[model samples]
Target: MPVRHPAPTPPFNIIRMSHIELGVTNLDASRKFYTEILGLIETEQVGNSIYLRGLEERNHHSFVLTKVERPHVIRLGFKVASEADLDSMATYFGTKGMATGWVTQHGQGRSLQMRDPFGMPLEFCYEFAQAERMLQQYGAYRGCHPQRIDHFNCFTPNVQASHDFWALELGFRTTEYTVSEDADPQLWAIWMHRKGNIHDMAFTNGAGPRLHHVALWVPTAMHIIHLCDLMSTTGYLDNMERGPGRHGISNAFFLYVRDPDGHRIEIYTSDYLTVDPDLEPIEWQLRDPQRQTLWGAPAPKSWFEEGSLLAGANVQPPVLQAQPIIAS
Candidate 1:
């Protein structure tokens, strides 16, 4: 099916998306897929977890796929401005009634952990350490050397509520959305940014608060095509969920796949940057295929059906339910 993508918007004040983390059953397998096949350089390995950075990025690591026995998100870490910003975020989350914890020795930097209203673990930190060794190898058999962890798509039962929380509390601005005029929108997907770019994180209405997919940006569209060809040769053609197409909003080329545990991962390239504060968020129709895939193949049922659960320690604050937001 041909999917219709939204018209590309002029670049605004968005900064680049920073990092994403995922919990996996087997660290070795996940590492093989991301490093060996995906071309990301493994910068650090701590216990059962592995930290990978795009070959192009000098900043520590961009993707952290951890080997956890349980199927849930350990946390999604974002880079902040300073230690003071981290402290301020901790206080802000606490006042909002969310439990916040601190991480002092992670590869990228010191981080604070918390949860969204529906229970998806979130972390904010500053000061990622640069990796001393950079990987020199690159090829088609080797995964496309992604440049950085781009954006994250999260699922929530109440899209508007989640959107409001991130926007009003966390300082994320919306870039684009899919909505309806009549009944409550079944799916309200919004592109939100922290530092800038199209978005750092996005929220979609679904089952509960869960991690949907982690995206990695490549240097070019050909790299994405090479990735698709490599996947076909590796007998993992079925893993390609959608795309090798353009996005109407960011004007980037994109391709999505599923990991062994059903976690969604995307390979993308050429999205424009946002650099202004006066930029308005773009809106799209719920039925618009362009909103998801420019060439269009409907997102798989599994894409709509699955998400990462929250970690035990990061449950959301109870007061979130009483906030003046409607549930989907």
Candidate 2:
């Protein structure tokens, strides 16, 4: 039997999602789409790389794009409350016999990179170069006007295993979850959070270790409409894939758009607060189609079958195989 590490006594303080690095084929076009179209502020451009932050963000960046031959997700970054948490996490994963390493990227503190029980590239670090907040610069806002990266939704073959590992070892709390109905209720998806909002990261049963979407928080549902108008008038209507609808699980209004490199980005808002540690996680049945989208249009097939492959050490990791839950 595999040994389980008890949740940290002091609980490693995972502040929130700090930033995400993505590999893009065209830096200039991607830069234009993210800055001019999506309305994220570009902090700096270093050769083939560009750094971006949201309107209300004080950090140097919440998202990054680097020119590559193809678009792919590089890493999922998280912020820890203290530097000590990095050491604790390193030791914690080390004791679990996981592959671990330290990476020192420019303008950022040392980051700990590791693959979770299931294979996914994850980085946790404490500090980064801070930037001036553009919250009051209302005139500078354009396009979709996203505020900050709200959360990441990932594809995993086994939601229950990943959810258990994240909740039991990393101290993430489940705010909501889905289970297939019938005689045996099998876990289908879960929304887990470290921050006060609904979720910092979520796992849905699918092909393993793929990123379904990265969500950028908008202030209201109207902003989601604004994105639709922006894309519609700008000749990128096809990029708009799904939503402007509410999710029954998180109660968040959402819109999904495909980036220049086919990476799915979600413009999201309006999830309820999950600050109470003792709060019970809301459960939904998989048979209820409305659970996925409260407004009642079934999710498109691409939403279920497609996702970006995880970037492994040398090549993409082979998808970890598992059976999907059947809703009876």
Candidate 3:
């Protein structure tokens, strides 16, 4: 089926996936992983929270780590086109019977926070504090360089409903998807994007409303390989969860690693462009092993069975469970 597009005009103009806020148990340990090892540039620190951005990002912060009792996601952030768009965002969600409110926080202005119909926490802000870009600052890179914040992949009980909310309600366009080929075929996953590359966020069939991983774009595949070598010798090899391999879905080079608090981050590169509105979304059958990894390696069980919790989300069970091919 061709992907459905929302009306040409939406209530607000969402620019792109902007940032993420995560609560971690150990601030010092998280800092060592993100800043010292992974090479995200620290922009600011306030109380128990630390603000960081990718090397090429000019936004004062694109990732926020805060000290909390548990490791959980606070919210995923989006950048709207303007302050007026921010207001429109609040109005649109509020009218939809979704929870919306203004949030006061550091490093950004006029932030609006909301929970989607599926209870995935989200925030939108128009103005952000700008910082010097570090794209050319080779010496500043501690190890593998994450150029910018990319897409987020998450687990939702109902991939179809989650896909509709983003594709038919908001204006995100699907670029790729996975479907079960059962007698009654069902969508098992959807990758939708607004930023003109591949995806800004993706939803996979699994437990309800949990973060699978947040991705950061690097310059090339070599960057990912470099990270693997760094971890292998740095006593963090155990933290490496999955690939330095290409994904059959996005066609991006990927590496998954766990932070000290076990929050997952994917170091990624090289997804194809999806700028043309007429681009047909690619489809893959659920049981096909290539859909998980293009080079034919089966995913580890943890990749499907585990995801980080969002604080107090109304979690639900998947309507239909998957029987994916996993490593033996």
Q: Which candidate is the best by lDDT?
A: 3
TM-score of each: 0.83, 0.92, 0.97
Runs of candidate 1 with Cα error greater than 4 angstroms are 1-17, 132-141, 181-187, 313-328
How do the residues 1-328 of candidate 1 rate in per-residue lDDT, one tens digit apiece?
A: 1111222331221234567777889887788778777788877798877887877677777777777787666777777667777787777667767888987757757777777666666777777788744434334225766776788888777677777766666667777776753354333567787655787888766666677788887878998898999988987788887777887657778888877666788888887666577676677776666666665445656666566676753323222121212212
Worst lDDT 10-window in candidate 2: 1-10
lDDT of 2 by residue, 56-108 (tens): 99888889898887778999999999999999888877787887899987557
- Clash number for each model: 19, 0, 0
Model 2: lDDT equals 0.82
Comparing candidate 2 with candidate 3, which one achieves the higher TM-score? 3
RMSD of each: 6.9, 3.6, 1.3
Error of 2 at 231 (Å): 0.2
**Model 2 CA deviation exceeding 4 Å by range:** 1-11, 313-328
Over the full model, what C-alpha lDDT does candidate 3 score relative to the true structure? 0.88
| Candidate of highest TM-score | 3
Report how far off residue 227 is in candidate 3 (Å): 0.5
lDDT of model 1 at residue 80? 69
Residue runs of model 3 more than 4 Å from their true location after superposition = 1-8
Per-residue lDDT tens digits for candidate 3, residues 16-109, read 8999999999989899899988999999889999999999999999999999998899989999889999888778777788777898779999
